[model samples]
Every structure is written in structure tokens, then in C-alpha cells.
Target chain A: MEYLLDGFADGLMRVLRADPQVMLAAWVTIKVGFWATILASLIGLPVGFLLAMGRFRGRGFAITLLQTSLGLPTVVIGLLAYGFLSRRGPLGFADLLFTPSAIVIGLVVLAVPLVAVFSMTSVASVDERVRETALTLGASNGLVAWTVLREARFGMMAAVLAAFGRVSSEVGIAMMLGGNIEGYTRTLTTAIALESMKGEFGFGIALGVVLLAIIFVTNLLSRYIQRS
Target chain B: MEVFFLDNVKFRFETDLVLDIERVTVSSGEVVLLTGANGSGKTTLLRVMAGLLTPEGGVIRYKGEPIIFGKPGLEHRRKVTLLAQEPYLFRGNVLLNVSYGPRARGMNISQANEEAEEAIIKTRCEGLIHRDAAKLSGGEKKRVALARALAAGAETLLLDEPISHLDEENSKLIVEIIKELAASGITLVVSTHIPEWASTLSVKNVRLAYGRVV
Candidate 1:
């Protein structure tokens, strides 16, 4: 108990002092999370819109596949990305293993389904009258779609924030793909795992606090957007 | 000159026939009233006329030219506008709602604003220009929606239950606006369940019973 208390106090102090190693890990986490979420959103939003509004063959199958992927374990993603990015694998020529890019690639795979399914729910919630209203008012098909998306903006933003939270706090992809290299590819989750195992409890606790803070801020932002 | 002509039109909601109009014609600058009971296909017919719904089997001609339902129907749709029974105001200020039609028609901001202001004044919504459209009262929403339709500069307007659910004063105000619109030579097709409301206007009455004109 005394050791835990001491570690907590030391971690609080390190957080307040802005320790460089902790800050670097937090920065890497933010960068990887942001880029992965952006790429995921860019791909997922349109796919989601199509899923919700478009009438096409096999659409139900596609949506069910996406929903099934939402429960996919992160380690599986890490393993698949590893297989593709390893030197002897199919994409081996890219030489991307153990790099931040590899971590982002793995995280993107992890986040896309989450973003897409949430976006689909958000857009589908918009009233059907919105489309008819736009069409009756002379808006082209593209403009009508834009209007519907505008109405669903807040929910879509929540989807993006959810993706950010998922990727930022995940450990498996960062561990397997980034290899938790010091300074270059280390992230908050990876650092927490390594530091705690090495008995650097203060460092691990500090990173945990940072991670919690990030998630709290994201949730607050989501609530604010929803209320707006 | 005929503005709209429908022959052998049929529409169904998953095999439950909603509209089966044998023939109907609306002339240019005419005020046509569609009166029917609930579930009598008044709204469905209005939607079909607005080009928002394609009839299952029919021929629809606008100004003597046949209207194709897909990409080719856009031009005809632009020339006609429909106001829903429960109007949906876009997420923005009243000005934005009013300006949406003109903006969608490719007018510049200033030009759209000018058209919007004109319609707003006509609809007696000048004071609500900056107010959020979603927060308006039911009557206010209907007026703003009508103003939006007016600003589109369409040749024809179709209003579904425009005065339904409003207080007597608001209903009278809408009737006055309808008269004004009719006098201005804009083609109008208005649907309502109350026959007494249509008695006040000099309009061609097209009564419907189970989707058939009676």
C-alpha cells in the first residue's frame, strides 16, 4: 500500500512537471490516433452514407459484415497487419514493420469499422423528410446528400471522436506493429505496459492518467457536440 | 396550356395501392384544390406531381413534354415545388431556410438573399429572419416553408395540408396568402381535408376517394 501511494504521488508530480519521455509518448499517441482516425473517417463516412441511403443489391450483407467487424479483436488486426507488412509477407517490399506508419496502418484497420457503423447509425437517424424537402426545393442529388449529411454532422463528429478514443487507448497494434521503440514509435498505451512491467510504476501511472484525461476530453467534446 | 397531365398513374406502398389516378390535368396559372379524407392519397398525389415519387405505371407530361422519372425529371422538378403536410425546415436561421431554394437553383448569395427577403415579406416572416427555423411554431414553420417554395421561382407550387393543425387566425392568414398567390398567376395545387376551407377560394376542385378522382 505504501509503495502504491508513493508511486501515485510520484506519478502526479511527474504529470505536473511535464516529463519529456511521458510527453513524447503522449505526442506519438496523439499523432498516430489523429492520422488513423482521419483516414478512417474519410473512408468510412461515404461508405456509411451509402449504406444508409443507397438502394443496392447485397447492401444488407455489406452492413452486416461491417457490424460483425466491430467486434473484431485488436490483436487479430495487429497480426494481420504484421503478416502483410513483415519482410517475408505479401507487402514485405514496403519495409514498414516496427514503424509508426505500420502502427497507423494497424490502427486504421481497427478504427474503420467503428467509424463506419456509428456513422451509418447517425445518418440513418436523420428524418426522411429532409431528403424530400431538398429535392422538392430544386436541390440536385448531390446537394440533397450534402444537406442530409449536414443535418447528421453532430453524430458524425461523435463517430470520429469515438474512433480517436479507440485507437489512442489500444495496446495490441502499437505493441506488435510499432514495437514500442523509444522516442520513435512509443505511445501512451505501449509505454504504460512496458514501464509497469519494468517496475517504473510512476511512469506507467502518469501515462495512464494522461490516457484517461484524453478519453474524458473526447467524451466531453462528444456531449458538447450532441447538445449543440 | 396544361401544366401537368397524368394518365393511367399508379403508385403502391409495397403492393397496397395508394394512387390509381386514371386521368387528371392541371392548367397553367390554375388554382386546383385536392380535397380528400385521411389515407385518400392526397399527399401521395402531391408527391407524384412534385416529381418526388415516380408512379409505377403512368404517363406524366409537363407543358406537353413527357417527364422521365430519373435524371431527366430534374428540370420538371425544378419548375415545381411541394410543401409537405408536416413541413421540414432545414437546420439554420429562417433566412437560410427561405434562401435554400434559390441557392439550390445556383443563384449567388446576394441574389438568393434578395429573393428570400421578398418571399419572407410575402409570407409575413420578416421578423423571424434571424430566428432558428427548427424552433419556430407550427404555423411559422409552414409559412417559412412556403416562403422557401416561393423563393425557388418555380412555376407551380403544391402544398399538402398547408393549414392543418393551425389555429383559426393562422388558417385564415394562410388562406389569404393562397388567394394572393393565385392572384399573382403562380400555378397552385393545395390539399386539405376540410371542404369549407376550399369554398372560400375560386379553385378547380379535384376531390379524391380511395385514390380515384370523384
Candidate 2:
């Protein structure tokens, strides 16, 4: 056990010294996670607001569908995205298979429902009079929607943070869709998996520590926002 | 000089008829008091006039021009404002809440702040300008909301039970402010259960029962 601890300490020192391989993997993880979160927010914020506020048929069903999708398996998403982006597929012309863009697309699919459902729930929880008051104060329809969004901004931010956390830690989509290519698509989770399989437990533990730190910071930020 | 004219207006919610008024006209710069018991449709009438709720069937005119339900243009909407019994303030300081209307209407921040500060001063809430609007007392929130409506420069103001939960001092201050706004040629439609407000403003009283003018 002491030997293991010593190896972990040594591995952490190497990581602290900024190993190029680990740094490259961290960069890819950050880029893929941020882009996926951005795409998800762009698609989710408006749809979620409409789901919460618009009077329409099938709104309940749409919300239920999105809510049910929150627990979707990462591997299933990876496989599905792989099918769509693989050679001879309808979108094969893009040649995006095993690329960071493919990983981003898969992660976005996983994140959109999370951001959407949370945003809808948050917007729905806003005070009923907020819309009426804004409208009565001479705000246009667009402005009323903006007001609702502003009121729910914190919840929406939490949703974004949650999406980033999920995609950044997910290994299935990164391994399958990203192909975990060295210096290109390799991410923290996939590198950890590879290092562990190769009996490099110390290096894997170091990566695991970094991943845990990221999750901790994300959760901390989310909790702070919720409290404020 | 008429501000609003409603003829044959009918509003239904689900299967129940809520409001059915044959005719009511509000002239410019007049204080019209709306008094009715609970569920008597006084609030519904104010809401319809504010363009927040659409009448199922009606011929409504604003300044002698036909005003369509659900599509009252921004300019027309800017000319009218409503204050519910319990008003809602956005998540911000008093200054931000008061400046919302002008900012929503595309006014620059500096100009909107100027108008908002002026309204806050007029409503006697200048001391609370930097305070969190959501944490204010009932009377202060109402006053801030009224100041927001004032900042909009609305020609017509519809207030529903503005002083319902206020103390005597606050109530008197609001009444004086309303009187001053009326004196400035702004049409006021105030709904309340208190008889003193109508008498205090010396306004014409219009009563409603079962959605009909009495």
C-alpha cells in the first residue's frame, strides 16, 4: 500500500510538471466538452423556454420525452452517432468519423435533453406574475420571453455546467466516436482507461484525480449559484 | 379625447362566461374608479383594457383607432400600463426594475436610467433605489412597480387594488401620487374596494356586477 501511495505521489508530481501527453488529453477534453455544451445551450435554451411558456398541443408529451431521455446510456448515443457518421452512411460525405467533431456531436446529443429539461422546469417554476407584470409594463412578447429567461438564468447555468460535467467525464463517446487518437482525440477519461489497462495504475490514478477535481469544481460552482 | 372605448365585449374562460360588457368609454385625463365584489369581473375588465387578456368578442378602440386583441402594437402597448394588486419585481435592484419598461422599448441605458430615477423620486422611493426590489415590503414593491409604469410614460394607467395591503401613510402617499399623475393629463383607471380612494380623488365611480355596468 505504501508503494502504491509512493507511485501515486510520483505520478502526481509528473502531472504537475505538465506531461505533454496528459496536457494534450486535457486540452481535447476541454475543447470537446465546451463545444458540446455550447451547442446544447444554443439548441436547448429557446426550445426549453417555448416548452415552458408556449400554449400548444403535445407540449406535455415533448417534455416527457425529453425528461425520459435524461437517463439515456452514453454507449447507445456513441453507437448511434457512429452509425450516422461512419463511411457509407448518409452523412458519410462529411468524413467526420473518429474525429473530435464526431465526439462533440455525440456529446451534444447527450447534453441537449439535460439542458432542455432543466431549463423548461426552471422557467416553469418562475413566478406567474413575472410574465404578466412584464407584459403590463409595455414589454413586447420578445421582451416577455427574455424576462422569463433572465429569471431562470441561474437554473439554465446549472444545466450548462451539468452538461459540461457529463460530457467531459464520459468515456464511451470519447473512446468510440473520438477513437482516442493520441495527440488528437485522446481525453482524460480515455487516457485513464488506457493507462489502467496497461498496468500504469499510478498514471491512471493521477488522471482520475484530475477528473475528480474538475467534477468537484463544477459541482461547487453549481451549488454556489443555486445558493445565490 | 377618449382613451378607450369597449362595445359588446365578451370574454370567456373555458366554458364559463367571465365578462360581458355592452359599452364603456374612458376619456382622457380622467380618474375612473372600478368597484365590484370578488369575481365580479372588475379585474378581468382591467386586464382586457391592458391588452393582457383577449376578449372572445369585442370592438375595442384606442384613441379612436381599432385595437386588435393579441396584437396591440408596441407603441400602443407603451401608452398603457397596469399594476396588479400584488405586483412582481424582477431579480435586480429597484433601479433596474424601474428602468425595465423603457429599456424594453429600446431606450438607451443612460436615458432610461434618467427617466427611472425621476419616477422613483416622484413615487418617494428614491431612498430604496439601490435596494433589492424583491426584498421590499408590500407597499414599497407596489410603489416601485407604479414607478416602473410611470417611467414607461404611459398615457393610461390601470391599477388594481394598488393599496390593498398598504398602511395609511403609504396609502395616502400613493393616492397623492395618482392625483398628481392625473393632474398631468394621464388617464387613470383604478380598481379598489376602499371607498375613500374614490372620494379622495373625487373620481366618477363605475360599478360592475356579474360583468355588467351598473
Candidate 3:
């Protein structure tokens, strides 16, 4: 108990002193989460809009599949990504496995379905009257889509923010694909896991605090954006 | 002279069948009235004519060639405008909403602003130029919606019960605006049942009935 107390005190002091490892982990987590989210949003947002707007023979079925995929396991995604980056897999030659890039790939995969699921509901909920109004006004399809998307932006941002939260806090994929390499693949969550395992309770507890702070900031920002 | 024709049209919504019509035609520069009790296919028929809904069975020919749907539908869309029964001002100021279409079509900022100013004047909404469109009153929102339509250069105005929720005076003003738009060579298809007001416009009338009830 005394050792645990001592570690906690040490971790607090380290945080107060601007420890390099603590800052580096936080920075890497932000970078990986941001880039992966952006890529996922670019792909997921338009695909979601198309899913909501365009009709096909099996759209209901496809939507069901997409919605189901939103609950996909992070470990499974990591494993699947691991295969692609492994020596025997398709892109094995690039030697990307167990690296930050691999971690980004995992995060992107994990974020896509999440972003799509929310954006789909957001886009679909747009009033048909607005669309009819835009159409009647001679606005093109692109313009109409833009209008609908704009109207649903608050909801869509919530979805994107949720994806960011998922990736930021997830441990399984980052540990598996990123390998938690020091000064490179190390992230807030992975560092927490690693420090906790090494019995460095103070550092892990400090990271946990930082993680909570990031989540709070993200939540506040998304809510603010939605309200505006 | 017919800008559009909807013939042998039939539309159904899931278990509720909505529209069944043999033939209808609207010539250019004519203000038309679509009226019936609520649940009549007035809105549905307008949707079909505007090419928003595909009739289960019908031919909608615009300009002699059977109108097909595509990005080209946007071209016709640019020519016709529809106003919904409710006012839903988009997020932005009045000036932004009025100029949104031109900007989307790649109009220069200056040109879009100029056109938007002209539309605000035309819709008599110049007073609300800088106000938040999303915060406007029912009558003001409708007029702003009209200004948006006007800015897009739409010549055919399709209004769905424009006065459904307006005060008596505001409703009367909207009716007067419809008459003026008709006189200015813009086609107006307004859906309403106030015969007192309907009689005042130089308009052709069309009535809607439900698929089964009537």
C-alpha cells in the first residue's frame, strides 16, 4: 500500500514536471486519432450520404449490414489489419505491421463503420420537404445533397466525435497493431496499459487522468459544435 | 405552351395509395390552383410533376420529350421551384440562404450577392437581409424560401398550401404576391381551398382526391 501511494505521488510529480514520455504519448494518440478519423470521415461521410439518399434493390439489407458492422470488435479489426501488414499478407512487403501507420490503419477501420452509422441516421432524418423544396427551386442533386448534409451536420458531428472517442480510448487494436514501441507507436492508452503492467501505478494513473481530460474536451467541443 | 404534362399518373405510399390521375397540363405563365380536402394527392401530384416522385404508372413529358430523371433533372429543377407547407429556414442568415444556390452552382461571391439582393427585393424581403433565416416568422420564412427560389432563377413556382398556417393578413399578402408573380410571367401552382382567394387570381384549378376514400 505504501509503495502504491509512493508511485501515485511520483506520477503526479512527473505530470507536473512535463515528463517527456507523458507528453509524447498524448501527442501520438492525438495525431493517430485525428488522421485516422479524417480518413474515415472522408470515406464514411459520402458513403453514408449515398446510403441514405440513393436507392437500390438491397439498400435495406446493406444498411442492416453496415449498422451491424458498427458493433465490430476492435480485436478482430486489429487481427484483420495485422494479417494485411504481415509478411505473408498482400501489403506485407511494405513492412508496416507493429508501427504507428499500422495503428492508424486499425483506427481508420474501427472508425469507418462508427462514423457511417451515425451519419446515415443523421442524413436520413432530414425532412423530405426540404429536399422537395430544394428540388422545386431547381437546385441540382449535388446542391440538394449539400443542403441535406448541412442540415444534418450537428448529428453528423456527434457521430464523428463518437468515432474519435472510440479510437482514442481503445487498447486492443493499438496494442496489437502498434506494438507500443517507445517514442513511436506509444500512445496514451497503450502507455497506460504498459505502465500499469510494469507496476508503475503513478505513471499509469497520470495517463488515466489525461485520458479523462481528452474525453471531456472532446465531448464539450462536439456539444458546442452541435448547438451552434 | 404547356411547360409540363402529367398523364395516367398513379402513386402509392406503402399500404396507403395516394394519387391516380388521367391527365393534367400546365402551360407557361399560368397560375394554377390545386385543391381538395386534406389527404388528397395535391402534394403527391405536385411531387410527380416536379419529378420528385416516380408515378407507379404515368408519363410526365416536359417540352414534348418524355422527361427523364438524371443530373439533367437539375436543369428542370433550376426552372421550377416548390415551397413546402411549413417554413424551415436553413441555418444561416437571410443573405446566405438566398445566395446558397448560386454559390453551389459556382457563381462568384459578388455575382451571388448581387443576385441575392435582387431576389430579396423581388420577394419584398429586403428588410430581413441580415437576420437569421432560421429565426424568421412563418410568413417571413415563406418569403425567404421564395427569395431563395427567386435567386435560383426558377420561373415556375410550386407552392404547397402556402397559407396553411399563416395569419389572415399575411395569407392575404401571400395571395397578392402570387397574383403579381403570375402577371410577371412566372407560372404559379398554388395548392389551397379558399375559393374567395382562389377566385381573385387568373388561375386554372385542379382538384385532388384520395385513391380509395373518394
Candidate 4:
């Protein structure tokens, strides 16, 4: 137990060294998370608002499905993505399976439902008075929606952050779809798993610590943002 | 030059009739004070004038043509604005909050600033122009609401409980401004429980009770 504790601390110190390999992993995580978040927001937030506010035939069902998808299993998502990207599947000519692109695609798929559901919930929570006041003031449709989003801006931000957090630390999709290729598709989580299997306890422990700290900081940021 | 007409207009909220106004005419440059007990459709009538609610029956006319309740409504939206009971200020500074409508209507940034500044000065809220609109005091928010309405270049203003949080001095100042605006051909409709606001203008008093115009 003492040896294990010593090993864990030393591994954390090693991972915190900011060397090229660790830095590379960190850079990839940031890049992937940022891109996934941007794409999710662009595609999901507006659609979610429309789904909540706009009258449509299947709105209720769509909202329910999105709500249910919020708790979707990551491993099941990985399987679905793998099946679609594998040979003999849809557009298999592009050969995206086991690539970083495949990992990103899986992450985005996992994220959109969360973004959409949270955005819808947030838009629904805005005061109805805001829309009525805007209409009474002669604000156009665009302005009305604009005012709602601005008033509920914090909720939209939460949706974005929540989606980012969901995708950033997810390992199942990364491992299955990315194949955890060294120096390429290998993410922090995937690398931790691989190093642990190879009995490189220090590297695995270090990566785990970084991931935990990131999750903690993200939670703190979300709290601070919601408060302000 | 009656700017608004409610000929036997009726409005229902859920199943209850909220407004049953008959033959109410608001002539141009006239200040009409709406007085009523609480839940007497004061706000509802104000909302009808502002085009926020559709009357169950009858028609409201602006400038002799009927209001169709479209995106732009009957009034020139660029020049007609309403300040509701609790003004919904956007997430921004006072200057931006005041300038939004004008800017959206194609006013240049500098022109919007000038217009917003003029409006802020008009409402004596210039001191709060650089302050955050979302965190303003109640009276300050009320004043900012007036400035924002004025910023729309509206020749007609419908104010609901505009003076609710104001002290006597500021209310008097606001009344004077309304009178001056009336003299300059701006139509005004102010709804309040207090009666004295009617005496300040070339005004006609209308009483609403239990959703009916009396």
C-alpha cells in the first residue's frame, strides 16, 4: 500500500512535467474538446431552441428522445459508431474507422443530444414575459428570440460546458473508435488505460490525476459561471 | 387624429373576459390616463394598445387603418414602442440596452449612441447610462424603461405602472415631460391606480373595472 501510494505520487509528478509527449496529449485534448463543443453548439443550440419554441408535428416525441439520449451509454455509442464506420457499412469507402476523425465523430454524436436537450430545457425555462414584452414593444421575430437567448445566456453556456465535459473524459469511444494508436489517436484516457496494461503505473497514475483535475476545474468553472 | 380606437373590443384570458372596452378613442397628442382597481384590465388594455394581446372580438385601429397584428403591427415599429410593467432589460450596459431597437432598424453605431444618450438625458438616467442595466435599482429601472421607450423614436407611448416605484418629484418631472411631449404631438396612454396623473394633460379619463370599460 505504501509502495502504491509512492508510485502514484511519482507518476503524478512525471505527468505534470509538461514534456513534449504529455504536452502533445494535452494539446490534442484541448483541440478535440474545443472543436466538438463548437460544432455541438452550432448544430444543437438553435435547433433545440426551435424545437422548444416552434410548433411542429413531432416536437414532443423529438424532445422526449433527446431527453432520453442524455443518459446514453458511451460504450453503446461506440459500438454504433464502429458499426457505421466499419467496412460494409454506410460510406465505408472513406475508411474513418479507428481514426482520430472517427473518435471525433463519435464524440460529436454523443454530445449533440446533450447539447440539444439542455438547450431546450434552458429555453423553456426563460420567462414567457420576455417574449410578450418584446412583441408588445414591436420587436421582430429575430429580436424576440435574440432577447430570450440573451436573457437565458447562462443556460446556453451550461449546455455547452456540459457537452464539453461529457466528451472530454469519455474513454470507451476513444478506445474503440480511435484504436488508441500511439502518438496519433491516443488520448489521455486511452493512454492511461494502455500504460496501466503495460504496468507503466506512473504514467497511468499521472494521466488519471490530470483527468481528475480537469474534471474538478470544469465543475468549478461551471459553478462560477452560473453564479455570475 | 385619433391614433387608437377600441370599438367594443373584448379580450379573454383563459375563460374570463379581461377587457370589454367600447368606443374608446385616443386622439393624437392627447394623454389618456387609465384608472382602475387591481385586476381591472388596466394592464390588459395597455397590452392591447401595445399589440401584445388579441381582443376576442372587435377591432383596434391605428391611423384609420386596422391593426392586423403582423410582425410590424400597425404602428411604424421603428417609431412605436411600449414599456411594460416590469421592463425587460437585456444583458448589457444601459447604453446598449437603449440603443438595441434603433440599431436593429439600421441606425449607425454613432447615431444609436447619440439617440440613446438623448433618451437617457430625457429620462434623467444619463448617470446610469454606463451602468449595468440588469442590476439597476427599481426606480432606476423604471427610468431606464422610459428612456428605452423614448429611444425607439415613438410618437406614441403606452406606459403601465411607469411611476409605481417613483418618488413624487420624479413623477412630477415625468408628468411634465409627458405634457411637453403631448404639446409636441406625441400621443401618450398611462395607466395607474392614482387619479391625479389625469389632471396634468389635455387629458380624458377612462375607467376600467373587472375587464369592462366604464
Give the winner by lDDT: 1
RMSD of each: 1.5, 2.6, 3.1, 2.0
Candidate DockQ scores, in order = 0.77, 0.63, 0.53, 0.46
**Candidate 3 or 2, higher DockQ:** 2
Least accurate 10 contiguous residues by lDDT in model 3 chain B: B205-214
lDDT of 1 by residue, A68-162 (tens): 99989999999999999999999999999999999999999999888899999999999989988888888888898899999999999999999
Better of 2 and 4 by DockQ: 2
Order the numbered candidates by lDDT, best leading. Answer: 1, 2, 3, 4
Off by over 4 Å in 2: A1-21, A56-61, B71-73
> How well does candidate 1 match the true structure in TM-score terms?
0.96
lDDT of 4 at B60: 84
Better of 2 and 4 by lDDT: 2
lDDT of 2 by residue, B1-214 (tens): 8889999999998988989999999999888999888788989999888887888897998998876545355566778888888888999999999999889888999999999999999999989999998689888998999999999878899999888889998998898898888788789999987767656565878888888888
Kept native contacts, fraction for each prediction: 0.81, 0.77, 0.66, 0.38
Interface RMSD of 2: 1.5
Residues B1-214 of candidate 1 have per-residue lDDT tens digits of 9989999999999988999999999999999999989999999999988888888998988899887564356787799999899989988899998999999999999999999999999999888999998789999998898899999989999999999999988898888898899999999999999868767667999999999898
lDDT of 1 at A183: 90
Clashes of each: 0, 0, 3, 0
Docking class of 4: acceptable
Interface alpha-carbon RMSD, every candidate: 1.2, 1.5, 2.3, 2.6
**TM per prediction:** 0.96, 0.90, 0.88, 0.94
